[model samples]
Target chain A: MPIIVNLDVMMARRKMSLTELSERVGITMANLSILKTGKAKAVRLETLEAICRVLNCQPGDILEFVEE
Target chain B: MNIKSKLAGIIINVSSFVIITGYGYTLYPSGIHNWMYSYKETDSLNLPVSQYEALNDSILTMRNLKNGYGFDHDNGQFAYLGTQTSIACDTCSYTWFKNNTQTYNQNYIKLNAWGIKKELPYKFYVKNKQGYVRKAVPVKNSDSKFNIVDVPVKFRYNTMDDAILIPVSADGASLFDTGWLILWGLNMIGLLFLLYLFIRFSYDTSKGRLFTRKNVTRLKLIAVSVTVYPLSIILLNLLVRFVFRQYFSPEVVLKDMVWYNAYIVLLIGIVLSLLYGAYNRAQLLQEEQDLTV
Candidate 1:
């Protein structure tokens, strides 16, 4: 339950909007929303690679473990 | 939360509906009078005289046709007509002939109001000034518990006198009734779509993660397919029944063959969906374990 998606934090640090990041990463706004809101049950490595490539970040930057 | 669990839930819900609806259709057919009668021998032979008289007339006709009719006291041959057969439901009734000498005083008659088959098992002896006259009972067995063991008389429904009984055999018609055929087709299409998703999910998950945009789209499509497919089947059944009533007579439309097919199709769909769900779940679990190692 505490598997957090830190895409929003990365986006904020990069000073980018969700729409801009989605377009750059070649993923849909809906999927980006899924990740940003932590609604996704799990993340595919390929998707993480695309996000990292576009945002100049690593998997660790976008995923974090926290206590519920 | 998992895709497999979600699919399993959908399968279970749809399977339950198919089973319940199948029983409902079997128990209640439109425009048929289904009745069962149980008679206890009384001292006065309290029977419906008019119905018995009608049955006697039919028996006389059958006897005349045979050209070898006799009132042998030894041979148990007789006729009776009556609406006294109390059907457990409001739909039908039965009547039969009984012998006073026989130790088995209890007689039963079953009438298939839709199919005009009557069975009367007991022979009744009527005492008249001339002597004893034997009578046979006219009743039909319409997939009910009772059977009229003698002549087959046509059943009448809603003032229609010429109503003929069409013997309904469970295996006479096509296995997939029209409604079931349609459901089966829909479920097949859904299964194909699910298979596509399953393949996509497998391919994506094999690459070590399911976060890809294509994988997400596939998952969404799978969820939507599972939710909509069964709901559409139920709605389509209602639509077909409505159309059937609007365009055809209820007597012709309410045959068991029509709905039996639908039930079978639904059952098959449920089974396939459950298998698909379980298979996908196992695959996902395996992928997760691989990732953990």
Candidate 2:
């Protein structure tokens, strides 16, 4: 419940549309939308690596912790 | 490729394959026979208490008629009036008369050889003023002279529509036939497996839960398969109809085609609804990730 996903901030900083980010990250637009909407239950290391490569960001920059 | 998602895929594929293969094998011998047989037990009531009583009474009356006329040991034939019509019983032969003529013959016999009286139940049909009637009469007292008084009987009007001429016994042995048991068992297992896979698919999270790219793609694949599989059946049926146009009427062909198509469409809608829930979950996950970033 406390897991964090920083997809929105990363998208804004990189100035990338969801479609563009999905293409760059090699994921589907539907999946990119999922990440943007905080619907993911967990994220894989490989997927995180892909996002970092596309947006030029660290994992910590994209993730945060919050108490539920 | 999380464990749960992988398991769900395996379950779906295995269940579909098993159902298709089982039905194909069972029906290949006689497709219509298998289909109609599946409906038979459900469509008609099984051997009810009333039917059993009717059978018992008929057998008892036949035996009484055999005894009353001092014909119990004679081995000669005797005929009497059944509740609905006239029934005749003999030591070796039995017939039922209706409309002033013998309308039924007992070529076959059902004997409870282990019973105290060692009696056999005989089945025959008679045509009366109303119509053809089917009755079961049991006969007893084989060692004594044949008498008309010992035959016990009850008549049952055959009300079954689309009667397949399948023999039914009051003993309930044929109800437990191996083929029927296997069919029902497989259907129950397949349904339970489907439910298990659905629950697992919903709760799985290793591939980032239902909303993740991999999981959603997997779900989409399954949904598409569910949709296309039934559609393929309809398409094949249509093609066959077209190829055999001279042999079949347009109305007959169209009716069957539309019925199956509608069924397929309903199945597709159900699958899509499940996928939509998974997609919505993915959206919520993405929004959470976006807010944190």
Best by TM-score: 1
Candidate 1 per-residue lDDT over residues B21-128, each given as its tens digit = 233333324422111111121113333665344434434322221211121111111111011111111111111222122221111111112222122222221111
Top candidate on lDDT is 2
- Residues A6-62, candidate 1, lDDT per residue (tens digit)? 888888999999999888888788777877886676677787888899889888888
lDDT over C-alpha atoms for residue B62 of model 1: 25
The DockQ-based CAPRI class assigned to model 1 is incorrect
Error of 2 at B264 (Å): 30
Listed per prediction, chain B TM-scores read: 0.28, 0.28
What DockQ does model 1 achieve? 0.04
- Restricting to chain A, the TM-score for each candidate equals 0.90, 0.88
TM-score quality measure for candidate 1: 0.29
- Candidate 2 residue runs with Cα over 4 Å from true position: B1-293
Which DockQ values do the candidates obtain, in the order shown? Answer: 0.04, 0.05
**In model 2, what is the error at residue B59, expressed in angstroms?**
17
Candidate 2, CAPRI quality class derived from DockQ? incorrect
